[model samples]
Target: MAEDAHGGAEDANVRGTPPGGRGSHISRDHAAGPGARGADDPKRMEGGVLVSIGALLLGMLLAALDQTIVSTALPTIVSDLGGLDHLSWVVTAYLLASTAATPLWGKLGDQYGRKKLFQVAVVIFLIGSALCGMAQDMPQLIAFRAVQGLGGGGLIVLSMAIVGDLVPPRERGRYQGLFGAVFGATSVLGPLLGGLFTEHLSWRWVFYINLPVGIVALAVIAGVLHIPVRSTRHTIDYLGTFLIAAVATCLVLVASLGGNTWAWGSPRIIGLAVLGAVLTVAFVAVERRAAEPVLPLKLFGIRTFTLAAVISFVVGFAMFGAMTYLPTFLQVVQGVSPTMSGVHMLPMVAGLLVSSTVSGQIVSRTGRWKVFPIAGTAVTALGLLLLHRLGVDSSTGEMSAYFLVFGLGLGLVMQVLVLIVQNAVSYEDLGVATSGATFFRSIGASFGVAVFGSVFAGRLSDRLTDVLRGQELPPGLGADALKSDPKIISELPAALRPPVVEAYATSITDVFLYAAPVALVGFVLAWFLREDRLRGSVTAPDATQTLASNPVERSSYDEVCRALSVLGTREGRRQIYEKITARAGYDLLPAASWLLLRIRRHGWAEPTALSEHSGVPLRVVIEAARQVEERGLALREGHDLVLTEKGCGVAEELAGAREESLAELLGDWWGPDRPTDLVRLVAELNSELCGSDAEQPYEESVPRPAGRVRPGR
Candidate 1:
């Protein structure tokens, strides 16, 4: 379960709005206006929010789990359905449908409403799951998987978007971290779970298991999840989407069926190849003319984006290809059970998790990222070479060692690809560039699975035919039978089993051998990737949260908000207040400055309301209010506190100071040449930063007076 690159891209799509889009309204509502509602509003009830979030997480888990869970069960599935040649289609269909449908789901949710759409997605996913579990043949299963993937894509994109509606910007990072944790957990647990169900119950359980989880998620969402729907017109790139999907379909078909189902130079293969090329050209043309392109073609013009995309594709090609075939190798050739194969794969999973975490931390710390991708691709190539050496007689220790190496290599590169793409693009291209990077990785994964199947099938056929030629005396145990059902090898006579196992081993390992050079290509391209200074937002500690999840569809505003939220959290409250006050040239306590900014943001605030909303002690808030009033910075009108003329000037100065500080942290991203959307984003974020009570000064920072002589100051 190499990280689902699709998740990262799709997550980005619906999380925020485009420059002049919904994000502007949200920022204005949350920050710049008197009508701004606090995230801690009593009407919302914290308990209900948590429950709703839990339901959303469950929905995301179902989508993500399916990506890796099926790997361990593929062997049993092919065995049950008897279509070894179509094994890759099971994975390819899901990926292809999900990838193509991701942007559409995001747009539809935006146009309609996410809550209802999310419910619809769940129902669709559950229906698809039921159909998959009940599938009687390989074609039916593959078709059902496509149905499942369509829903799965919606589940991933909308769940994240819905979180944006439920929580304020300040808390988004913390919750997105939860989503990242889900992806991380699934990466390790999916294969294991699939193995457990396939071994203990049946392979069908892998699909059936989604029914209960999806049902609960659907019910909870329908019952409790409520968010305002702001209808916006969107011109979806329908022609572009169709052309690109057709292009991918044609290419995948050409790769998967070219050598096995049809000859490489045969009419069908040639027609697919020619059709893919024509569709690709047509897709490019349509993208140029589309009002809102699915993937902007201009992204390819940037050197860093292009290079990162190439590396991402190659990484996906190697990672998924290996993940898909490794289980078959262990179960068929090494004679390990489904569950044991999953257990044995843990070394690789552990290696990937460790390396991904370590690499992300290092990048966050130093702001230097080129080294990881370069080293990762190189090690990946080396790891694949190591895996190619695995054989039927290979020791468990040796096999584990190779798997760990491959996983480490993959981990080192996976997270950095998105960061570099984000850094390389301008604010305008930020959302698309992020999505584009992961999109290529996903497409690469589809191609990898398809290509590997083609190679494995072709090689296994030739090897099995050569080894078992003229020696099969059994009734129904033919070469095709052995290919269709690997279980038959165990039933083969003792003398014939050795050569047959050798055939399977050589065919599977040869896939790794062929893939090693592809990884090497990534290693070479890695050298060409431009090294750029990481943006403060991109290098924030919680940045990994953004990268680890399924991030496919998000807007530039949401992307920036999430990153800046992490940056704001990382920079403690006291320090941030101190910096703003210093920059504003105000000689006041940080708490007083915080109070002025908050009052300015909401137009008016009562000291009691401020104390209650922000977790600061009432005494401390009254004291700060006293100080501001003493300075004539704010005036008391009945029970509400409003900034005076001078206080308004000071608050504006402080707001400007906060914006400047944020801009400085963004490096070159902020400046005279900065995009208008970015300028708006920084302003909105400044308001959000002040609006959030989570960043209020600690209770210990301002102690209560020994004498409690103040009722209303």
Candidate 2:
């Protein structure tokens, strides 16, 4: 077993080694773990699962927050750095680097290990953040921001990848939905936080704020996460990585520059477009020949994956396009402060939070998920259409309703696409598949932002000219200046300001009108998506089957499976509480009871671990622990905790009660005379959240009696 586990495999294609020169070398043994099933299976909770997940989620938030946070601080940054001509690159640089590095990071995580890669990414992000904060010039700030993006991209992708490792697909809905909610929350929070920091502290604080929070996350992940080092041998496709990065850079440049910085037909724009195409072609050609492709071309062959990618792109396009202009409509047209405009966006974020959370829970409960995207994209298109109808006289409430509809639609579709793609791919391909989907989305956002910027610029210029007619502007003011310096419009003479504000409103609305068709395309694509079953088993995908196949292990496996499934549900939690209450000879509240159990289970734990493991507040855990200690249930010896004689008895009783409860829950439903395949039955029940077994790999048989499309459902 050790020999197989330690066997070395050569990876001659390795590139971009860390400073320590850790090359891409790995080995694996069947006795240690087998297949993607083993690799992707949830690691057994050793008292800190929630903590690890929380830390990873926070890290992802740092990445997501930076994307929007910088927008509010950009004007200040330009003023400080004095490079008005190069202003757009401040944001574009980060977008460009992030988009370029995303796939490379995903592939590297797959080649090595996710935990280490994630940690490295976070460190790089922090370093980049520090440099950005200290940058003296626009050139330096932009360069450092790109550095930040390299790490930021990895953090975003790797966080999701790690979640895949931690939770089975059947149970990932809530967590993934929560991740979506975080992204949505940050969309509103980032700008608000940025404005606060910029106004109260300095624009540099926007980057500096990541320092303490990121350090906490980094420390938590380093201490708690324990992904097994799987020895695997694979070549890293350096050429493919370079080609893909090159293509992404070119595409983002074109998207960011075309018709905004340069005219659409200009040589610069045309050259970048042609170069992007050439690099894309080259990337595809290289992937075909490489030992390991950054994005496996075979993924496109899967209908669901292909469809999801397309829909993700379209969703990003429409969503970003609308978001890019919504503030303009609220602030420039309606004459609200930047802060108030952000406040006005709250309805959208609220809708997103509610819809994403509710939809995820529903998907978890009932395996039917196809309806969400179909309805979501359709609603998204409808919302965009409504926004298109907004006039200069539209009320705040009217705009709020429009934002809510649009946000709800976005929320429903965002995480569901990732779920669909993950469901379609095998465990080994999870990271790359996710990164690929995100790459499309990121690129789509780039295109959306660019194209909409062009549309808004042209429309506003024409509107301003038409509105002004023969009227001359103040010295040093023109239509072009108004487009660039939006604040100047509010300072114009009352007669002139009304026309400019109306013109701004018209231009922004036109962008939304143009984006409505993109959502419609996504709606069409959502219809073509085939819903597959989510994986429900917490262990290796076929662990249930393997145990059932062995006659000697059948009875024991059945018991284990039943116990796990029961414990996985809400009612199961009630059962646990009852077990503890019954054993302790008194009413132990949920937090106190859970803390005692964890203490008993782990022998000793810090106060933080107890809180984290049990999902109790730290203050609650500390108070409960103190109360228990005063009652002679637990005592602290030095820094370690130990149970007394009474405590041990209570622990023993709780354990017995738990066994009894499991036995009762898994007991025969029908009379004992007729035997049932309880093991298979429990497995099926758990897997049911994933839909039918039609899409499961052939080797993993999901047995069903004849003539039932869905047997238990």
Candidate 3:
């Protein structure tokens, strides 16, 4: 069973119970969005969402940092561990474990609950990090890195799934944009920090650093992150998961081992290839029959989902392939220290930050997201081709420019694809869809690195052999020694250095030149993506079963449903109210009612904030404030709006009036038996309606109980 997006929980104001009184007792009817939190959920109304997001970003930082931070330190690790043959395994192990675990985490989160699962993931990640730091050999490190990847996979997927739980779809872009920025920031920070640790301290510090941050993130999530959950028995698809994992592992192993550890036509490589293909076919068959498939085959039927998943794969391929090798080229060929190489990568990070932040804001404002992916992938292809132009003597400025273009293209594509997939699915499928897309991207990264590693190694080997063929070798060293490590070339005879460095530079460029077409495929795929209309809210109509369970209420509740649906989301809900008022021959106070409820639920922040969040025009909100003041319903004490005793009575009357009017409209269908849980329905109704699920404005608002907290207090 798919868990509720917001998890399990009832509300304090769920019944007509006043503050400090017992909440209405009721059975679970429908899952409420995070915005639907009652007065009972501690801190929901008082900057809790922002606080929770802050903690999530820290978790995201840890995951992203680990992926790239180890890049610059890899050479040093190889030198220390003396396992040049197992170098790729260090990265491959993590990617393989992470790829296999991604879908399972999402499925388990749905079956159980996200909060506990996410917390467990954090603990596991921290434990793995400590183990990695303690590892004394290559095999130990690889095994520990696999452990880290297991937890890392959950960190990436669950953090995104959690956002779906808290924010509605309409408001998701803004937060997604922020998350993009966080990813970008960590990308830059990771390399720089890794370089610093490897250069000034021990490379082991790279893993140890996760301890403090992970602890803080865990504490924050455990204490501040409240997800009410109800568990039901689930048919876990172990067979399907195993088949998919097998397919991914086999394919990645082929890419990593073929042409490197063994000949391309070797029996081991050929058998693995055939096995992977057969497993893929079997996996598809398994998914078609599984009660709850790990990766739902139905998702493939969605055109946008399929297209976005492919594009995500291509982007990941190009991105990881380029990022993994660029620092090596800079540090070895350019003769820069690890720290300087990380600093030099700043141009790319800057481009990414600017493009991602700007594009996200544009998407939020305009909702025209399709153009970005098309244009971004095209630019990414161009950037890769430009990188192919670099030679051994290329200037730092030239390299930075190429990297900048690449980063811009990457930034534009990455976040939007996730948004596209999320927007395309229902809330129940949010976790699955999210992890599926991530799984494909991760699989792509694994293969891209493996394939490109093969290409780079082959090209570099051929060039090195060509250059060193007739030359006299040193007494103890041979050509194969240079193939194992780049640092060996730096330590070679001065006369032999230029040719080897030039060969490496040429090979790196060759890798990019060949990889360009992969991004081009993404550009082409972007054109086929259908632009589904972006929703104004994230409410999944089917997720809540309240109306569906009540046949009469379900049939007659259309107008009420329509009214409640737009309660706090859109500006056009006013028209729905106008129609409601017309039928009852009563004036409807849409603005006043919304404002009063806003004040009641979250207390006061600012008039302008309410306008922005509620989607009402600022002038309309200001005028509504005036009308409420004139009616003695509210008074502006300084910047804060307070409801007096008389105002509270009027507010109650307005609330009662709206409910009575709605009930009367359905009176015939409802008959004399009013729903016993009208309060829960209203709360759920308004919860679905409220814009509280929307992203908070840039200027943080700390709301307190209106008029309850004295100025001195």
Candidate 4:
């Protein structure tokens, strides 16, 4: 819904496949982190990995920036292209194409490998951008945008998924935090950048700008990126995907053109309505029987998933509708330059960032999420009502205040919607539920833009007609010309300009007034969402995951891995080691158990290196090594500690214990009938945790126990 760039992280690897093609059962040898796939792996090389990450970030930026940047340029585009009635189509087409293509891209990447798919996606996006820049008409631009959306959707999904492939679970949060920061920055910078390009350069520059960035990303990715490809058989739900897309298209068409483009009762609108109904029924039938349904029909039976989906749709409807038209109101009626219009929208972006961050932190801490959505929707409705008060003479300050209120309301709801759906569904449903929630939001955005456009176009036409009933216009100047381009008002007689400006202002404001009821619907629905105890993974999501604007498109395993990674990071070395040691029920100190597991994972652990890397004191590392050896768990070979046969057994037991402990946090998700993929995830995560130096146990500056002898002594 936010045109979030990192949608594909969850689907980075094929779901249900054992990580690295290891056996289905947990193995002691697999205890090494998946990051250790190959010594020559480019993703593991410190410098090369940075370069690769930079390329991925650039790819994500190309996609994300396009989503927000185009909004500010829409007014200029329509004016130049002379088709105000088709304005919304430009945005709707992109959203529709991207939303429909997202899952397919992710699945294709899993099948054919992401690196090649990623490059292909980049090329497609660049081609679309080039075509869009060269377009001469509204229809051409709209069609080109859909082409762009197809590639843009893949860029977002694959870039995020590739992160999972490139980074181990332990260090993933740090990098993902970077991705989240990018999303946040784009939210503020996108419109501003669009405004600058439109005013200083040309509207065409907005599309052209992506060319240089995307080409660089493509080159860098091709040269430096290398990830293993594991192909697995998949049954893609082609029919379900097509039907859903068709249904959404039909509904959006009805909303956009029903009253304005065609009479509401006209045959075209009636035909589309009936077609949409038929498509909906067909989609359900296809989904119920499809091997891998796009939107699993069973999820609707879950109350939380259903309610969250609806609320998400409403949020998307309200948020995108306001975003699409606010620029037009500022530039056309308020008489602000395109660049200044972007500047004036900052309050709303700031409000959204602040509230979303705060609400996420609060929910993570308190585990009560229902209140935010309820309050958010209520405030959103209020903000819409406040926006309705804007007139031709509304001050910049008044507009900023109203925008901030509206943004604050949106932020509170957006972050929690995914979390709600994830917490509600079973392990098998986690991935689809997350994607489905965002999918609804995306469809809502398409509807909102279309509906808002219809209202604005119809009202503007009627208002201009009423006000100019008896006015004498310059030769060739008419209401139609004024409707096509707001700039045409400047050519009108000085007396007529006032009525034209007022008409533009009221028509746009009335749209907000009409949309308030939509937000109110979300408010009422929020009251019905049942508050469940938060899963540990959902409790403390990485800052990037929490603050990111896009829907987190990940499989169940990746989602759990990410959550566990965050939890492991937040717990730090000492706490996690203590818990795992206790769960292991071994007759050894936590430090000694950690040493054995570490040695077993890597074959050997140098005491000094261990202390330096893990922040465990040199004395403690030596003492732990000595203890393991005294217990015959490990043996000293030169300066490194190597696991003995008994040590290997103990280490495997410790790893198993760690896996069980991690699985316990999932609650019902780890039931007896848990999916094998989840079992694989738990095992893989345990191995990574044990092998990662970043996760090695650390003790604060504390003296060793009195009974423990110095290693030399």
Clash count for each candidate, listed in order shown? 19, 5, 4, 2
Which digits, one per residue and each the tens of the lDDT, describe model 3 over residues 245-312?
78978987887778877899999999999999999999999999998888889899888899988987
Ranking by lDDT: 1, 4, 3, 2
Give the distance in Å from residue 242's predicted Cα in candidate 2 to where it truly belongs: 2.8
Query: Candidate 2: which stretches are off by over 4 Å?
Result: 1-58, 71-92, 106-120, 130-143, 157-185, 199-202, 215-233, 426-431, 467-469, 531-713
lDDT score for residue 422 of model 4: 83
Model 1: per-residue Cα lDDT over 1-713, one tens digit each: 00111112222322132122122222333333335656633344556778899999999999989988999999999999999999999999998898898888899999999888889889999999999999999999999999999999899888878877877665677787787788878888988998999999999999999999999998888888878897868999888988888998999999999989999999999999998999998998899999999999888899999998898889888888888999999999888889888888999988888888788778977899999999999999999999999998899999999999999999899878888888889877887788788888888888999999999999999999998888946787989999999998878989999999999999999999899889999999999988988888785323222232223687887788778767777887777887887787766777787888766655666787567656788977888899888878788878767778877777777777987888787777776788787776676566567534756865474443232212322
What RMSD, rounded to one decimal, does every model reach?
Answer: 7.4, 15.4, 10.6, 6.1
Poorest 10 consecutive residues of model 4 by lDDT? 1-10
lDDT of each: 0.81, 0.63, 0.66, 0.81
| Residue 338 alpha-carbon offset, candidate 4, angstroms | 1.5
Question: Candidate 2 at 584: error in angstroms?
Answer: 30
Ranked candidates, highest TM-score first: 4, 1, 3, 2
Q: How well does candidate 3 match the true structure in TM-score terms? A: 0.73
**Which candidate, 2 or 4, has the higher TM-score?**
4
The candidate, 1 or 4, that scores higher on TM-score is: 4
**Total backbone clashes of model 2?**
5
Give Cα distance to truth, residue 553, candidate 2, Å. 35
Give the CA lDDT, 0 to 100, for residue 157 in model 1.
Answer: 85
